[model samples]
Target: MDKLMPQIESHIDFFLREKLPKSMPMVAMLIGDKTIGQIKEVFVSEISVLFPQLIGQYADGLLEDDRLYPMLTEKLQSAAVYSYISGTQSKLKGLFSKVKWGALVFGLIYGLLIGLIAA
Candidate 1:
């Protein structure tokens, strides 16, 4: 073998330089115009622009679907809600206590007037 490696390398180079083009003509559309780096940049920019809106919508959907009803129910069932109602009731009771005698007299007069009117 008289320097077989160099001969093989020369033939391979010749094939790549000449025959490859004939066998496969370069198609610009098939090998897209944009580079991998350019594509990655566009993808990153688009995601950055849309990510917040997407996350907001997703969070809203989760709140509507999974949290609203339970949250309302929890509030309705909470001791704080009952305490608030009881606080109002206790205030009314305190007011009524201060005016029980007057209120009773007023009620009796109001009832007698209504009964007289009816009769």
Candidate 2:
């Protein structure tokens, strides 16, 4: 685990710096201060859950090579990206819905005002 710390930290840094922004711009914007905190939380949570089992498997020679490390990183990245993208999509949908309602309300008010003036 100690041996893996540096690499894991680097991966986390890379994901936060490069991947998260490109993948989920809305979430990043919505939670500007909390973005890094949320990402680090996810990273720690995932690593804590998986690292022990992974290390055990490596020690038992169950894993063929160090391929699992990269695989694990990819899995973590994918999970984060998926989570953020879903959240962003939901936010966007809600925003669009609100805009639609606002337009409808504005249109109705404008039509009523015109009708009153024309009368």
Candidate 3:
């Protein structure tokens, strides 16, 4: 049997190759176009050009399906939220070293107010 073709030739790079090695093999062979679309528009465009047959046939199941988009969007939004929250948590963790106990209480109140205002 022939070895499976690399999904995109002349285009793969180190960062993407790292992410892709973990992709489910069955899913990669089949609906991989829509899978790459979630990564970026550039990947979508490249897949369309490089592997039109597979991507075109499975496009709806992978790309246009309602279930897929919502999950992808939620993942994206939650990543952003988690990133910001982790940064804030790190800052707050460091704050404890600098303030006196009474001042820390005021600082916490001020931090909450600042967060509210920023949001």
lDDT of 1 by residue, 14-103 (tens): 555456556766732243325433544564556556767898999889777966888878888786878899899999998988799788
The reply for model 2, stretches above 4 Å from the true place, is 58-119
lDDT per residue (tens digit) for residues 11-30 in model 2: 88778777877898875576
Top lDDT model = 2
The alpha-carbon deviation from the true structure for residue 112 of candidate 2, after best TM-score superposition, in angstroms, is: 99
lDDT for each residue of candidate 3 in 1-119, tens digit (9 for 90 to 100): 01233434334543344445566555445545565555655754665666657657698568768799899888987897878988999998778666667697898999999999999
User: TM-score, each model?
Assistant: 0.30, 0.40, 0.25
- TM-score of candidate 2 relative to the true fold: 0.40
Cα lDDT computed for each candidate against the true fold: 0.68, 0.83, 0.65
lDDT of 3: 0.65
Q: Which regions in candidate 3 have their CA more than 4 angstroms from the true location? A: 1-51, 80-119
Candidate 3's error at 3, in angstroms? 12
lDDT (Cα, 0-100) at 18 in candidate 1? 55
TM-score ranking of the models: 2, 1, 3
